[model samples]
Target: MHRFANPTRFLRLAAAVLPFSAAVAALCLGAGLVWGLFFAPPDYQQGDTVRIMFIHVPSAMMAMGVYAGMAISSAIALIWRHAIADLIAKASAPIGATFTFICLLTGSLWGKPMWGTWWVWDARLTSMLIMLFIYLGYMALWQAFDDQTKAARAAAILALVGAINLPVIKFSVEWWNTLHQPASLITMEGPKIHESLLWPLLLMIVGFGAYYLTVLIFRVRAEIHQRRTRMLRMAQADRHNAMQAAD
Candidate 1:
């Protein structure tokens, strides 16, 4: 961990792994889409409409996963004062927010046909909505500060506290009288899905995870560059002022 504390070293490592992450993401998404759209049998109830779950479910899974990643990174940044960890938490906010939005939008589309309504006050849905707001609030906190260091610290604290929603999203159906279905893939009674469908769902999930990694690396790289550029500009300005003083 300490070995790669230097951003330059981390960038080199990231460069090596970036292409592989993209490749795996492409491979997994391609296979998942093919299997989900054609190879996997249609649902007995919803028929073709059920196919949307292949994308929606995985995005929903990733939404929560990204938040959890941010929360952990936030904790690490607070305790260990790791710059990369803070960068990760900051860089991932918009992506996770986008994914959460997709989950809600797609879920609503799916629910319309199945539940005969576009909106619900269900526990899971409400919690997911709250997740989105929390993400926005975190981002706002970061940008509202003139001091970047203070912004990072404040956002990290918000992220750690917002983590309480993860469990609520997970166990929502079990805990409340809600219209949302309980866990299908991961449960104490084992998966309720068929193996043929399960494989594609897993593939889509892995693809989503890989895609997240790829995007995160890109965002972090850009952020590091921006910081470097800012530092360089500051140094140049300082040097110019020093030269003028000597004159």
Candidate 2:
């Protein structure tokens, strides 16, 4: 991990991995969407509406997954003062937030037909909403200061603090009398879903993960270049001012 602290080395690594991640993302998402939507049999109960799970479930999982990643990166940044880790956490904020929003949106859409309402204050839904707020707050903290060092530190702390919500979000349905269903894909007994439904869902989840990786690499690389440009400009300004003073 420390070896990747060097931006150039990390960028080279990212360049090599980018193509593979992008390809996986495109292929899996294409295959998964088509298979789940057009080919998979409808649920005995929900009928056509079950198709939404392909989009909703994966987005929901990625929303939490991305936050988990941010929390880990934030911990690394705080503990080791890893610059690349900080940039990674920073780059991930918007993407995580986007995923959270999609989860909420799709959940609502799915809920309307199944639950007979477009929204609910159930434990899972409420906690997921809180997750979205936490994501937004995390992003806002990064922009709250001019000194990026302070901003990074502040944001890292918030990220670490907000991580407590993750478990609550995950267990909310089990802990409370919620409208949400219990775990089907991941449980002590393994997936309860049928193979036909499960396979495409798994593919979608993989695609989403790959998509996140592909985007994170691009964002982190852009951040590295931008930071380097800023440093070069500041150095030039400092040298010019020193020369003028000497004159």
Candidate 3:
């Protein structure tokens, strides 16, 4: 694991995985949306409003899931000083943040019909909102310092601290009588969602996840290349100065 921590080596590995990931994400997403939107039956209660579930639920799941991933990466980076982990955490931030935002937006849209309001002060909703802020904070910390090691350590600790929010978001329903619904997919007796809506919803969730992974690899690779380029330029400048001094 440490051996692959070298950015150059990570770049090579990422390059190899990129094509396969891209293909899988694209295929899964395509099929998932088609099945979710078209083939699936509308909810008896929510009707076409249920259509939002295809996009909303998956994005919400990914939002939390991605943050968890970021937290784990942050831990690895802080403990092992794994270079690639920082790259991954940095790359995952915007994607996860976007998903969280999407979850909130779509939920509002879904709520306007069902809950009769665009927003709620429920625990789940609030915690998720906080999670979004945490994402922004993590990104800010990474860029706040001029020193790389200091920045990474600071951001990693912040991420770890924020991890408490993950479980809060997960069990918010059971912990309190919030407006948010309970778990539909990963439940005590399996999914409570009907088969018609269930499969498509799952597909979309998976597709969204794959999409995040596809972009994460590309972004991290670019970051590695950019750092390498910066190093090369600095080295070139130093060598040029040394040669001039010799002359």
Candidate 4:
């Protein structure tokens, strides 16, 4: 972790691996979608509509996973003052929000066929909606401040607080009387889902994870460049002021 504290080193590493991650993400995501949509057997009860699960489940996993990552990054930023950590946390907001949105959208599409409604206030769904709002709020909090340090602190605090929702989202189906289905792929008793369906779903989740990493590296590099440009401008302004004073 400390090895990546140097932005230049991180940028070089990111550049080297960016293409590979991007390619893997695309290949896996495409193959998973094709396998899941075209080749996999349909659920006995849900029929072909069960195909939505391939996209919906992975997006839901990524939505929560990304927030967990943000909380970890924020913790590092606050405790260790790692500059890159703050940039990572900041860069993750939009991507996480996008995943959260995709989860909600795909879930809605799935629900309409399964639940006979376009939306529901089911515990899992409600908790996930709250998470979406949390992501948006964290991003808004960052923009609310003029000082980057203060913004980082505020956003990090929000991220830490909002992380409580992750558990709620995960357990909502079990803890409450909800329409949402409980975990089928992961269990103490082993996966209940058939191997035919499970493998493609796993592939999609891995693809999504890879996609997030690829985007994260690129966004962090952009943040570093933006910060450097800002610093350079400040320095130039300071020099001009000093020269005017000398005159």
1-247, model 3: which lDDT tens digit per residue?
3123567677678788888878877888899888888888876666777888778788888988998899999999988988889888888999999999998788778768776788855455666677788889889898999876688788888888889655765576446643445433221123257888887777787778778988999898887877777778888999999999999
Supply candidate 3's per-residue lDDT for 237.
100
TM-scores for every predicted model:
0.88, 0.89, 0.86, 0.88
lDDT of 2 at 149: 82
lDDT score of residue 1 within candidate 4:
41
Q: How many residue pairs clash in each candidate?
A: 0, 0, 0, 0
Best of the two (2, 3) by lDDT: 2
Measured by lDDT, the strongest candidate is 2
- For model 3, the stretches where C-alpha displacement exceeds 4 angstroms are 1-5, 165-191
RMSD list, candidates in order: 4.2, 4.2, 4.3, 4.4
Better of 3 and 4 by lDDT: 4
The true-versus-predicted C-alpha distance at residue 177 of model 1, in Å, is: 4.0
- Model 4, 220: alpha-carbon shift in Å? 1.1
Off by over 4 Å in 1: 1-5, 165-191
lDDT by residue (1-247, candidate 2, tens digit) is 3123568788889999999999999999999999999999987767788888898788888888899999999999999999999999999999988988888888788778876788865555566788888999999889999988899999999999889766765586447643445433221123256788999999999999999999999999999888878878888999999999999
For candidate 1, what is the TM-score?
A: 0.88
| Selected candidate, larger lDDT, 2 vs 4 | 2
Model 4 CA lDDT for position 245 = 100
